[model samples]
Target: MNVTLEQARALDALARQGTFAAAAKALHKGHTAVLYALRTLEEQTELVLLDRRGYRTRLTPAGERVLEHCRKLLEAERELEAACAEIRAGWEPTLRIIFDGIFPAEPLLRVVKQLRAEGAGTRFHVSAEFLAGVEAAFTRDEADLMVSVLPPTLPDLRSYRLADLKAVLVAHRSHPLATQRGPLKDEELARHLLLTVRGSDPRLQLSTGALEGRSTVHLNDFAAKKAAILEGLGYGWLPEHLMKRELRRGELKALKLASGATHLFHPSLHHRAGVRLGRAASRVVQALTGVELPTPP
Candidate 1:
């Protein structure tokens, strides 16, 4: 109570982000201003908050205590504001969701629409990227919330399970091997050209030795892989959601590789581990899924 909330917040921002410049930008001030404020705060409290070494920043024992108090105070303040808003004017305020290309647009869009219908005045900014693009974006702290194929968890990152996507082999109906359906045997593929995503994950499923006699084409991402197939290059496995239009329009047809031979890829919602999620992310979590990822205690 000796220190103002602004001082506590500055300390929290630096501790959570691990960089002075980043914390400064987030607090809407210059790096020098943050430095000056923290210096003043520490002088007033007569305690060290940050253990700074060259460009690296870390919280000291005292700083850690300050951050804990800061988070509690901030959460209380936010809850108070939300209570007043809920009683006075109904709204979620803001939301930014970064998603993978595989999750499909319609379903996620529908979720956002449903939230609005519930009187949640949420503004949604949906960023759709290919698998790796979205993953990279999340890692870079560019997205508030993420929906992507599960990757190895990164430090200071938490995830929630969303749904599963089934991938299947696809081809133009006029292809020679189009008639051979119902859990395709690898033997049958030797006669048809093959298109697959270029990566260790995709390669693990598609072996070079297995495709020895087959004509193979590897592309950067799903969009490119789908494009290669559209040009009649080769048959490629695609996400169930991406091929909905083609499946319905007879432009592309899905072939079952094997009965119950499903690849159950998980789509998960992810957010920064320690940093608290903002209003938009919270609303999306509550509205779309009845789940909220707990922040570090």
Candidate 2:
């Protein structure tokens, strides 16, 4: 038996409104039309979908199951209509953004939340990568935009300086290096493990703040590296922003290095040169450049 979307819609309205007249009012249709649609749906499915015996109509057990499926169809139709409207309004259907994991995601996510509320209907696929992995993913996926510390030397690349990420060399308070008063020497640091995040793209060789001939452990992301460092596993560089609570609690201490304890990473927003950005991408760039960005929660 073939069931129509119109029939599904009628059943949905009837289930929601709880009465035929109420359902008709909600659908902007006559009471008779609503009744006919429900009747046809029941006949087509060979199921007693509605229990009309009640003072106010209610769906039978089978009707509830059918309603669940009908709701999905209605939701899909709504999404399709929304997508079409977005396309007509010159919003890109999808935007892929690859950013360095070291960069804070709150600002970008806050901007996205604002854009979504403003009816900028671009679907976003955001990925956080480490160092060279950001550029690698951006090039491999031909992503719409990227936020990276390693700006690729491509001919048609456009980049805008977003923010400087201050990275501090840190270790757990209980670690041997934490007790050292003076600037940590090369030999002192080399004696412990260096917790570092491995780039997503293994083929591209990259490292940050690593010493030669040091005992090392590669991790997947900064979160894992942070966990390892907090467990007194090793010492490595961490974003200063991420260390605020730990530093305040005396759980993690910044190392005073002979070379330097802190370094600045200039992560920038990059896109293809000469390519005009859609509304969503433009908003992202604007927000990243400190234009009316919401305060971090």
Candidate 3:
């Protein structure tokens, strides 16, 4: 009931690092200090926090629940500090960006490096989502800016064209479809398993680049989808940028559709309408908008 923030932080650190010594090292404090804080917290709360019987320290059931709350408290404290610092420096305290999985990673990384190089003080949090997942992140107020492919139209949202990505249907070389001659028919494509990225929306499951009525395997992320394709588990559309090495190495073969078609995915940057962007966010937007990625050959 009267626990201090330091005590709460020690509990969180101890839960994460699994031992007082490791937690102390992470917190840049003496081991005894970490122990003292956690013990003080336990005494104040009248709860047994650490189970010290095993080789590795662990949280008791009550400790686990208490630590969960501590984590939230710590997160809020961090945000508060960041906000104060940003206000003092005339910058936005934090910027949250969610990028679609299909978007090229190299350019994003470059932009981040450039931001750091400029000594920008804005705290950045970035995450990757696929398909409707990107839009969902935005709608949930989880991000301040989003880069997405075919983002759903929403009221009070503004969008700008960021870049286009080339996507091609592909499968592992060992897959039977890879041996088929000429453009593959829809029926032929449907017979094979389709690896699709799962959407984040709980109310409505969504998919892109998937043939209707096809046998499918849904994966959580692009990396998992690519891995499934590499394992010959299924064929699916992949960003050309991500599969270049695999294609060059003959590990994956592009599937020629009946129309001999490849898709150009237009990814756009989005932000809430009427929301003023912080200096760092604006710079990031400018850098990304100006970036010119090489067209897939």
**Best prediction by TM-score:** 2
Ranking by TM-score: 2, 3, 1
Local distance difference test, per candidate? Answer: 0.70, 0.83, 0.79
For 235-259, candidate 3 gives per-residue lDDT tens digits of: 8878899889999999999887766
All candidates' TM-scores? Answer: 0.53, 0.73, 0.65
- Model 1 residue 52 distance off true place after TM-score fit, in angstroms: 64
Predicted candidate 2 versus true structure: per-residue lDDT over 1-297, tens digit per residue? 777788889999998899999999999999999999999998888999989897999999999999999899899999999899887776888989999999998988998899889878788998898887788898899898899887576668878887688888899999999989998787788888887787222232223244624477889989999999999999888898887999999999988876677877788888897777777887788888854322222
The predictions' CA RMSDs to the true structure, in order, are 15.7, 5.6, 12.4
Residue-level lDDT for 14 in candidate 2: 90
Estimate the lDDT of model 2.
0.83
